[model samples]
Target: MHLLAFNGSPRLRGNTWTLLNQLKRGAEEAGATTEEVILNKQHIKPCQACESCKKTLVCRIKDDMAPLYGSILSADMIVIGTPVYFWSMSAQMKAFVDRWYALDLDPIRPRLAGKRFGLVVCYADSATETASGVVYAFKSAAAYFDMRFYEPLLVTAGDRNDAAGNPQALQAAFALGQEIAKP
Candidate 1:
């Protein structure tokens, strides 16, 4: 099985990346080939809502996102990792999520059907508000694509990089990965 994880945190070694790496490690140990893409470093354009994909089943922007479409569709599991910003996901993550609109064309809409989706969220505070938006976003995405909604892996106190090293957080992340990798 193949798993694709998109890390939307701008900091390469930030808390979000650390948690995502934990998930990746578990998946790799389970014999699943995994790739983690750092979305902030990629040059992906926001969707223009031109409605062209409705007929062509493809996006017109022509950027890094095009290549990801195929990989995303083929992957058995997909994970979105991002840090909470203003009580929601980062702008980079939002751009990528919006681009999924391109997959709305084919008769079997949302090429992600049957795939398992996992959400990894990092937040600065313990307040549930920070995670609420991202959780909702993941749910909506899963619903739209008819994909299985795996339980989210959330790391609070994410304001600091060392937060990811917390024993409890790491344990939770490992457990989440194991659950997602289960048959």
Candidate 2:
């Protein structure tokens, strides 16, 4: 099995990254080949809404995102990790999500169809509900694409790298990864 994780936090060592790393470890232990894409290090341009890819199956703007398209398409499982900002996902993850429009050129047929989807979110607020929008976005997309959307792991009260110190959060991430590895 091949699992691909996308870390959408700007900070490489932030809470979001910590959770994703733990998850990756678990997936690897389960015999899945796991890879992580750090969005901050990649030059992924925002979707221009030009709709060119709707017919060509390619993006007009050529950059680091070009390679990720193949990764996203080939992965058996996809995990999206992000930090909650203003009751939603960070700008980086949102931009990445927007670029997925390129894969949805056909309303009935999506490139990521039938893949397993998971989400990991870190938030400062005690109410993890603040990340509901991010959850909804993934859930909606998964449903539209006939993908399997797993229950998300939300780590609340995570500031900076606080999640690294939270044993429960780390365990949850690991467990989620194992679940994703199952056939």
Candidate 3:
């Protein structure tokens, strides 16, 4: 299986990054090849409402996002990990998601239909409320995109590397990776 993970946290060593790495380890152990893209590191322009891709199956803006379209198409499972900011996903994550409009074309819809999608959200606050919007965004997007949505892994980590110290959070992420490995 080919599993692709997108890390949307700006901090390269933050909780979101740690959880995604642990998840990657589990996926590799399950005999799946994995590729990861850190959104913060990439130069992605915000999606314009031009609607050009709706017909052409391509984005008008040329940048790092061009290649990810192929990666998304090739991967068996696509996992998106992000840090919650102001009760929502990070700006990087939001931009990445907005770019998905390119794949919303009718011809490409079948390619994504029933594909597995996983969400991992990290926040400093212990309350689930802090990241509910992000969770809902992924959940609703998965449904609209016709992808098989898995239960999200929501973790609370106040420190940058706190997720690495939280065994439960790590295990949950690991389990998510393993689950995605199944056919």
Candidate 4:
């Protein structure tokens, strides 16, 4: 199986990326092909509600997102990793999610149906409430694509690099990856 993980954190080596790396390691060990896309480094534009995708089943915007559509559709599983910002996803992550509207338009509805989906989130606050909103956001997006949602793995950290060298979060991320890769 192939898995594509999208890192929505702007920080290159931030908590979110660290956890996602652990997940990728586990998937690789499981003999599954895995790839990571750093959204912040890509030139993806937010949907403009142009309704072009409804007609052509493709977005009209000539940007990085055009290439991602094939990868998203071809993946057996997809993992989205983001850092919580003010009890919600970061703006960079939100922009990536908004582009999914192209895949939701007519003739492209359920483009990712039946694919497995996983969520990984990092929050500055230790309280679960701080992660609740982001979790809902992932759930809603998964539902829209008719994807099967897997249990989300969340890590609470007091510092930006809290995920680094953290064995527990790393283990959880690896386990989540294994589960997603399993039949």
Worst 10 residues of 1 by lDDT: 156-165
Give the Cα error of residue 122 in candidate 4, in Å: 0.2
lDDT of 2 by residue, 3-97 (tens): 99999999978898899999988888888999999998888889999988877867898988888888888899999999888878888888888
Which residues of candidate 1, in runs, are more than 4 Å off? 108-110
Per-model TM-score versus the true fold: 0.95, 0.95, 0.97, 0.95
Q: By lDDT, highest first, what's the ranking?
A: 3, 4, 2, 1
Winning candidate number (lDDT)? 3
Please give the lDDT score at residue 112 for candidate 4: 87
CA lDDT of every candidate: 0.84, 0.87, 0.90, 0.88
- The parts of candidate 2 lying over 4 Å away from their true place are 107-110
Number of the top-ranking candidate, with TM-score as the measure: 3
lDDT of 1 by residue, 63-106 (tens): 99989988888899998998999988999999998998887766
Write candidate 4's Cα lDDT for 57-147 as tens digits.
7889999998998899889999999999889998888888888878886556666889999999998787878889999989988887899
**How many Å off is the CA of 136 in candidate 4?**
0.6
Q: Over the stretch 1-183, how does candidate 3's per-residue lDDT look in tens digits? A: 898999999997889889998888888888899888999999999999899897677899999999999999988899999999888888999999999999888888688887789889999898988988998899999999889998889999989979999999999999888887765
Which regions in candidate 3 have their CA more than 4 angstroms from the true location?
none
Question: Against the true structure, candidate 2 has what lDDT?
Answer: 0.87
